[model samples]
Target: MDKKAKALELYLEGFKVVEIAKELGVSQPAVTKMLKQFPEYHQEKERRKKENQEKARQWRNEYKKQKREQYDEDYELVLKSHREDAAALSRRGKLSDDILIKLCILNYDYNKEKERLVFNESAGKRPADLPRSVYVHKNVLKQFRIPTRQ
Candidate 1:
């Protein structure tokens, strides 16, 4: 094969210009010069790079979608189980104030952790219509070392 054709082939196979040059028994600059002689080679390489990037982005979006669906399904199951347990305790007359308080604290901690994750993922952009009072409440909770709910 001609040097240009060989270089193009190697380049398409994800070889660096230096490697292509070495394989073709030419200098790196010579390889670059040969590639420059064919503008179509550069165009095709760019097109392939974009195509690969688009495929990766699509895959990432699909993965996120699947994860969200799974999370929603699991969350619903857990919520139902929690409600059933609460109802059973209430029917047996075992749901005391202490138990209720503990449950409240557990729910609060779970919500706070979820909020922190969301805040971090949003890069610190506050949600719309968030009350100023809630910010003050959070500061107060922080001062008291009490975790706030999401």
Candidate 2:
């Protein structure tokens, strides 16, 4: 359960001491103690870990120094490309009447779908002999979360 034991296990498994020290977030001197307790070749792995950490820190600093205008230009390019795509879809007659009908019901983003209203068949006050067809719209039925056996 201790970090020293884990470092020892990792060393025996041929992981570089630099990797062990980096993973355990400990100094080489401390790692040497864990290595001595386990008595394996963990020394080199620790040195490599410090180098890896320095490289990682360098990348993080560079990322933080990135400019806001770089992101703004990316947004402008994406907006221009999307406008062209919409115009193309419109020109090709891809946005037809039937497609528009389905799109308005399903693709109107937020206000698109119907709400569920319960009307159970078995416990109904309706007539005894009824048709077996699905009466509600498929989208409306989905709102009820009903389990259909058929």
TM-score of 2: 0.26
Write the residue-wise lDDT of candidate 2 on 15-127 in tens digits.
76688899899987888777776434435556667889999999987886675667888999999999976975686656543334333333222222333233344544433
What are the lDDT figures for the candidates, one per model?
0.65, 0.60
How many steric clashes does model 2 contain? Answer: 6
Badly placed stretches (over 4 Å) of model 1 are 9-19, 26-30, 89-150
Candidate topping lDDT: 1
How many residue-pair clashes does candidate 1 contain? 0
Summing lDDT over every window of 10 consecutive residues in candidate 1, give the lowest-scoring window.
114-123
30-121, model 1: which lDDT tens digit per residue?
99889887876778779888989999999999999999999999999999999988786876676644444334332222124322211222
Error of 1 at 70 (Å): 3.6
Top candidate on TM-score is: 1
Candidate 2 — which residues are off by over 4 angstroms? 39-150
